[model samples]
Target: MDRLPRLACSDPRLTRLIAIYETLAPATLGALEALFAPQARFVDPFNDVSGPAAIRRVFEHMFETVDAPRFEVLDAAIGAGGGAFLLWNFHFQSRDKQRTPRCIQGTSHLRFDEQGRVLLHQDHWDPARQLYEGVPLLGGLLRRLREHLAAR
Candidate 1:
């Protein structure tokens, strides 16, 4: 689990961003045009993209690859200068029927423009625990490696 700096949630801008993310879906990706600036940047463990279309594409891809993908915003903080941090869990079921629904806990750091549209979004999470550890052969190998490293 990565620790993130705490932020206040009193800012309405931050509140709106949280709401948008909590209710986000591929069909409602159009809502991003209102939540994010045209040139807003988004980055995560797997993606580094800018602009609303590119960002929407990321979410679209998630929908295409997963089942019932959703976000649950757990907490948030608002900075004095339009910066915010959100702690959330991304819940989804794997495309493969054998796999069950899982939750990936992560934190989003966002910078909003003066008008309250997101200007930048960065995410931090542990891929080993959230993703790779659930894989088949790779899961065992990664778990062993983690144990080996932790013991040293």
Candidate 2:
């Protein structure tokens, strides 16, 4: 953690984004638009959406699909050209019969506009291991395939 670059408190945009994520919920989902520009783009393992409305829908789906999804920022950093990076964990319980809670480790790369609103947000994560492998039927098959591959 010591080696990770800390986002300065002065960076209001990034700070606010972090704050909202830490306390994110269905009601607060609307506020996420304030953190991004009107035409901002967001990309993740399963989504490629542009604009605040589209982005909000993704989060909405997350909440609707998962039991209790939340994000925890472990570290953050600011880069040149108003860019930022956030290392985080998404924890949730599957809505299916597999009600066990799980955690997905991921990182987000963000580019902000002059107003400190995000222009582009891209997330990096492994859906196969973090999500699909947790499913009941698919999980077993995926786990077996993973084991076979690892043996080689």
TM-score for each model = 0.88, 0.86
lDDT of 2 by residue, 1-152 (tens): 22335445567777899999989999999888778899999999889999999999999999999988998887887887668899998889977665888888999999988888899999999888888887789999999989989955
Worst 10 residues of 2 by lDDT: 1-10
Clashes of each: 3, 0
Q: Report the C-alpha lDDT of model 1 over 1-152, residue by residue, as the tens digit.
A: 44344434677887777777778877788886578798999999999999988998888898889898888777887767657888888889887867688889989999988787889999999999779998899999999999888955
Best by TM-score: 1
**lDDT of model 2, residue 97:** 69
Clashing pairs in 1: 7-77, 8-77, 8-78
The per-model lDDT (C-alpha) reads 0.83, 0.87
Clash number for candidate 2: 0
